[model samples]
Target: MNWRRLQAVMVKELRQMRRDRITLAMIVAIPVMQLLLFGYAINTNLRDLTAGIADQANTAGSRALVMDIVATTVVTPTLAAETPQQLMEAMRRGEISIGIVIPPDFERRRIEGRERVQILVDGSDNAVQSAAAQLAQMPLDAPVRTGPAIERAISVVAFYNPERRSAVNIVPGLIGVILTMTMVLFTGVAIVRERERGNMELLIATPVSSAELMIGKVLPYVAIGLVQTSVVLALGLWLFQVPLNGSVLHVYIAAMLLIVANLTLGLLISTRAQSQFQAMQMTFFIFLPSILLSGFMFPFAGMPRPVQWLAEVLPLTHFLRLIRGVMLRGASLWELWVDVLALLAFTVAMMTLAISRFRKRLD
Candidate 1:
């Protein structure tokens, strides 16, 4: 290791590193990305959960009470329900996380020291459950400060996971996380692996159309993804005792859409990556945001408004809603059709984009 020779080697390595723009950019981009995500996007202390009000009381005191809850900023009143059943249905549909049902007898009950303000909490999200639970025991000491500081018991009913078990929330979401990790990792390197192994020439020489090749590449992974989903759901049910109260068909339908979307994303990454390392870097770039911002770890309602809009674009965000809505809430497919449509649209659009990119690369 002569000094001059070592210096020459170092210079050569620096030049090589400089030439790899993706690697160099990622070195800077990843750290900045992590900082932004953890600092701004990843918030565990959730606020502003979507809420509904069913003001059957129609009285000044009841209205005052509703205003008091809103002022707490624990929940934002976004929907209007005529009855508690309708409010519960809204929670089941994943529309709103909290439901305030002020019965017609609220005024009478308040005066009689029994104003049971029914709060229905969607307990499938642990962070949300925790935040909304505060509302139950929260001293409404100053909320209704019109008269003599009258305190009332909040009849908090946690629907879905009444126990507020962490597993109930985490297990269902694990399906999307697992699929995203394995499927993207597996397919992100597919085309790049071919290039690395000197099979690109053979692929180019073959008569297979780009569409056929793209289908052939991703089809096998679809089956594997479904299998992975089965294993995760089964383990979640068996080991964690997490309930699956919805249709098996619904779970698969959502899982398939997510699977295809991730695979296509991987394929798209494959089209751009010159090597497996680059493909992996690109995959990781997406993986972090998908987990952090997709409401898998943090509640979507907790994110800032702009961040929530950003989350809406992620496929995992929509799938989590569908999966949780089905497994925990026992919601019907039609009830969650908006999320269903979102996943379907993501799959179709991503698949088309991946195919076009692959064809362009092949050409």
Candidate 2:
């Protein structure tokens, strides 16, 4: 090959790249996005986990113990629970990660060398479970008789997964992660593929409106999403022995919401993308952050406030909570209605955007 011909072709390709703003933007944006996500957003050390406190003794000793625990910064006591029942309720609602309970006979039990403090942990998340375990092992210093400090005894009790099995947590989250990976990717290329394959004319020749066409295009993929969900759940139950303590119906309902939300988002990206490559880039743009920030691989309670707010916007984040609540905690959909509502709202918004932006006429 001639050097001149190779240089000429390279220049032609560079010109084409300059004209494609989305591709250009992605080249710059993705690295910065990754840097920000890894540097600031993603945290695995697990700090500031939301905690609830039930100080029954209400004495100086009980308060000092509580202070010592908080000083460790492994968990932050954000809720004031009057009783252990209230603490369980908060953990049940996903409001707190763990509960700190000081018994009424805390000091008395200390004298008798019995357990005084109980740490109730939401064990659905392995990271949070690890944090709870770390907190349990912490030796909080309290002057027993004004001499050298005596170590405070903390008892740890895990709520959902007593065994703390990795599969128990990973399998449920894998459902959401798989759907987000497939459903968005499949439909992200759907409309663009039509244009690339010269099917736009056939579609436009039909009497269907843009909204009708968009809905029809995504319907088949919805079934595919469910099939994937069933396969994962079945394997989880069969191989991993993952528990289905809650209603399977609740799991399906939650899965359906997430499936539709992801499909709509893919369609939205399809409308904006000029080609299958552009669509894939945009899908990755959404997919990467969803995986990182949606509590799929990390504890939601451990993230900073801004990161948590950003995570709350992702469909997977809410779905993770819903699926885990149903499959592990035996929680009904009604009990986790807040996350359900967020998913519903996301699906509707993405649907509206995809339809309104999609033009029946070719670009």
Whole-model Cα lDDT per candidate? 0.85, 0.89
Candidate 1's residue-wise lDDT over 96-135, tens digit each? 9999988898767776777547888888887877887777
Among the numbered candidates, top lDDT falls to: 2
Structural similarity to truth (TM-score) of each candidate: 0.95, 0.95
TM-score for predicted model 2 compared with the true structure: 0.95
Clashing pairs in 2: none
Q: Model 2 — which ten-residue stretch has the worst lDDT? A: 143-152
Model 1 off-target regions past 4 Å?
Answer: 140-143, 146-151, 359-363
Q: Mark the regions of model 2 whose C-alpha exceeds 4 Å error after superposition.
A: 140-152
Cα lDDT, model 1, residue 172: 89
